[model samples]
Target: MRIIIERSNLLRSLGHIQRVVERRNTIPILSNVLLKTEEGAGLRLKATDLDLEITETAPAEIEMAGATTVPAHLLYDIVRKLPDGAEVKLGLNEGGTQMTVSAGRSNFRLQCLPEADFPDITTGTFSHSFTMKAQALARLVERTQFAISTEETRYYLNGIYFHALEVDGASRLRAVATDGHRLARAEADAPAGVEGMPGIIVPRKAVGELQKLLGEAGEDGDVAVELSDSKIRFTLGTVVMTSKLIDGTFPDYQRVIPQNNDKALTLDRSTFSAAVDRVSTISSERGRAVKLAISDSQLVLTVNSPESGTATEELAVGYDSDAIEIGFNAKYLLDITGQLSGEDTVFMLADPGSPTLIKDGGDEGTLYVLMPMRV
Candidate 1:
């Protein structure tokens, strides 16, 4: 292959495609990025690690149309270090096996693999295809991705669950994720004609890649999404990302949310979050439990540890019910607090050791459940 591409465009595509390349590969070809030049005006760069793949095309001046593979990370670093606006020229040696890259005063040679060695991805069989605003997709990931399970044994909880639902006679799209300790559920009005799409479990790696791509596409741009029973794809302008779905059934999370919690406390979000963090210093590492003491208009957060001492902080809240004492993990409390984009947060409590429900003071479509800890 002999092609010339702008330095900035080449570097950007490298940054996106190289992320899917594994650092250590049993097969040498898997460590390389495949570069193919078409008969027309652009070059396509692809990288994969069996589980995920990223393909992006950049406009280039092609003298000869061909394909070759080069070490992904090394090539990316070389091009990135070059001066901006410089033109990058790539060519195959006389034997057509060794590849050379040149830009500015720097030059490098790398071993190449044939195009037939790269794994082919079949994107023609998607059962569902839809489009939505990039900002909406980014918001869905930001609102619920933190609750994804890190435990390897419970494979079903390892990713966000995307499904279609109906709310108030209107279609809605929802993203749900949970660890054993907490659950986060967020929903938005589904785009028109996206009502009957089947549910899919998007693995954690794919979620991360989509997040990065969406960030680059900006908030106003729209993204096209395609999915099959076994794979998912996201297309943003000239970039495309595809990955295999996690083959596991997610547990029904609705049963765990408490429906009858009568006691409610509304507090300034920053004040409550600060109190929880300040008092939890005395909590033991195992439980990290902080006790909540609520009265007429005051709330107290206390943490007691046998090894350490005790710490307490008080806050003024909107509560007018009987005194209620409850315990919760400090980490869980912080997770819920960090998800808040509003000034005030509401907490509904049932008892000392039951599940507590939390939501933004003004929104009902997003709800969280945190299991309490014993004090």
Candidate 2:
């Protein structure tokens, strides 16, 4: 294929498609991106790693209509290093085994593979579809993705669980992620046609890719989502991404959320997070646990490590319940607290042994459950 494309336009599209191409490949064609051009449709770029596929189109001036495949990373790097605003010209060699890239004074030839060798990931009929603001979807991902498990044994917990639920007497779309020790849940207004949508586990990779696209679209832009039993597709502008959904069922996360945590501690989120950070400096690198002592309106944070040292800090909070002492992983506490956007954070506790519930006093749609750690 022969085409002339603006450097900026080509670079943007390449940045999105190349992410799907694996750095290491067992199949030759899988490491390359399929580039095709048509008379009126412009240039089409596609990349896939068997489980996920992303396709994007860029406006280009077409001189010839054909298709070829080239190393995705190499092409991206070439375009990225090219001077801004320069026009890029691409053409297939006469031998059909190489592709030539020309921009300004730079010229490079890259080995090419036959486009026919690329695998097609067919997106079957979708049973459900919905549209939501890109920002809303981004918020859902940010609030819960950090809690997704990295372990592979319980594959179901390796991604976020998305489903429809009734929260505070209103139906909403909720996303939940957990790694046994901690869990995060966030909700947004349920969009139309999602009332009976089946609970789907969106694998970690797809969530990350979607987040990148959404960030580019901005908050006001809309994204179309299509889902089937085995696959899910997201459409953002001219870019289309499809991913295979995890087949295992997600564990019921509600069972672990504490219902009757009688003790409540309300404190400035910034103050609490700062204290935790300071105390964790002296915590052991392995455990990194911080102890919290809560009584009346006083809260104290302490960390003790055999090799480092012992550190303690106290802060005044809004607490009226009986005294309670709990130990928690400092990193886990920081992660959950970082998600709180409001100034004040509330912690609901039942006892030292029970899981503690945390919420941003202002946002009822988001909640976190953190398991206690032994000091």
Candidate 3:
């Protein structure tokens, strides 16, 4: 393949595609990106890690229509370092074993893998398809992705759960994630053509990449999503991403969401977050418990560590119930509060051992449940 593409265009496509390539690959071809000339269309770039694949096309002046594979990260780095506005010329050697990249005075030769060696993720016929504003999808990921579990044993909890639900006669789409310690749930009005979709678990890696691509498309742009029980695909503007879904079943997250916690505490989200942050400074470990003492209208946060000194902070909150003391992970508290896009946050507590329900005043469609820590 021989093509002349603007450095900016080539770099942009490379930046998007190279991230899917793993830093270490057991298969030689898996470390390379497949580059093919599209005649009048443009130059197509593709990279994959077996489970996930991303493809993008950039406008280029095609000299000879052909295909080749080259190291993804190396190509991205080379194009990224090229001077702005420079034109990048890519040419395959006659033997088809090497690719050369040239821009102005810079030149580099990259080892090439046979295009035939590249693997493709077979995307069978999709069972359901839908389209929604890119920003909306991005927001859904932003809301719950932080709660995805990192444990490998619970493979099902490593991704966000997405499904179609009928709520109060209105169809809605929901995204949920939980790490056993905390759960985040966000819902939006379901877009057309998403009915009868099976609940799918989107792996953490795919969720992160999709978030970046959708955000780049901006709020005005629309994203096309297609899925089956085993795989999912996203098409945003010129980019296409296909990923294998986690085959394991997600646990029933709804049962974990608190339904009837009556003790309520309404406090400014910023104030509470700040107090938790300051008190947690004394915690020697990230998961250390921060004790919360609530009485009348005052809330006191205290953290004690044998290695460090005790830290305490007090704030006046709106609470009306028997005074209750609870313990929670300071880091978990900060994460939940940071995600609450509201002036005030409501915490419905049942007791010291049970989970607490958190709601945002600014967003009614989102809720979070956090398991308490033993102080």
Candidate 4:
């Protein structure tokens, strides 16, 4: 294809599409991005890694209408390093085996693959569709993504579980993620057409990609979501992303959430996070465990390690229940606390061994359940 595109616009489109290209590919075409130019439709760019695909379109001055595939990362890097605001001209060579990229004083030729070799990941028929504010979807991802499991054995837990549920007699869209050690749950008001939607486990990579797109779209834009039994699609502006959902069923996360954890402790979110950070400095690298000794109106954070020295810090909190000592992974505590947007954090605890429920005092839609660690 022959097209003239603005350097900045091409760079942005490439940045979004190339993320799906695997660094190392078993199939050569999987590492290349498909570029197609049309008379009135501008330029279309597509990249995929078998399971996920991202397609974006940008307005470009078309000189010739054709299609070709080129190394995604290499093209991205070339466009990125080109002078800003410079116009880029890309054309397929006469042999149809190479693509030439020209921008100002710099010129490069990249080997091309037949566009027909690219795999198609488009969905056939979506059973359910809904629209949500970009900011709300982004918030849901940020709050729960940290708890997604990295382990491969339990493949079902390697992504966030999204479903519709009733909260306080109101319908809400909930996102939940857990890795056995800790869990994060966030809810947003359910939009129209989402009632009775089946729970879907979105893969971790897709969640991250969607987050990036939603962040770029900002708070004002709306994201269109289409879901089927096996795949899900997200459309933001001129970009469309399709991903395969995990095939396994997610565990019953609500069962692990403490129902009657009545012992409540309220403290400054930042102060508590800082104290945990300070104490964790001396914690062992492997466990990274920090002990929380809570009593009436007082909380002491301590860490003891064989290689590193012990650390202890005290902070005044609003705990009126009986004294209890609990050990937790310092990193887990910090991760959950960082998600809090409000000044105060609330912890509802049952005892030292049971899972502790955490929440931002100002937001009832967000919640966290952290399993205790042995000191």
Q: Report every candidate's CA lDDT.
A: 0.88, 0.93, 0.92, 0.93
Ranking by lDDT: 2, 4, 3, 1
Q: Tell me the tens digit of each residue's lDDT in model 4 across 238-276.
A: 999999999999999989988999999999999999999
**Candidate 3 residue runs with Cα over 4 Å from true position:** none
Error of 2 at 307 (Å): 0.7
The true-versus-predicted C-alpha distance at residue 13 of model 2, in Å, is 0.5
Q: Which residues of candidate 1, in runs, are more than 4 Å off? A: 281-286, 305-308
Residue 110, model 2: Cα distance from true site in angstroms:
0.7
Candidate 4, 116: how far from true, in Å? 0.9
**Residue 222 lDDT in candidate 3:** 94
For residues 150-221, write the lDDT of model 3, one tens digit per residue.
999999999999999999999999999999999999988899998999999999999999988987997599
Q: Measured by TM-score, how close is model 2 to the native structure?
A: 0.98
lDDT of 2 by residue, 287-346 (tens): 899999999899999999999889999999999989999999999999988999999999
Worst 10 residues of 2 by lDDT: 115-124
Tell me the lDDT of candidate 2.
0.93
Inter-residue clash pairs, candidate 4: none
Worst 10 residues of 3 by lDDT: 280-289
What global local distance difference test value does model 3 have? 0.92
Candidate number that wins on lDDT, 2 or 3:
2
Per-model TM-score, in order, reads 0.95, 0.98, 0.98, 0.98
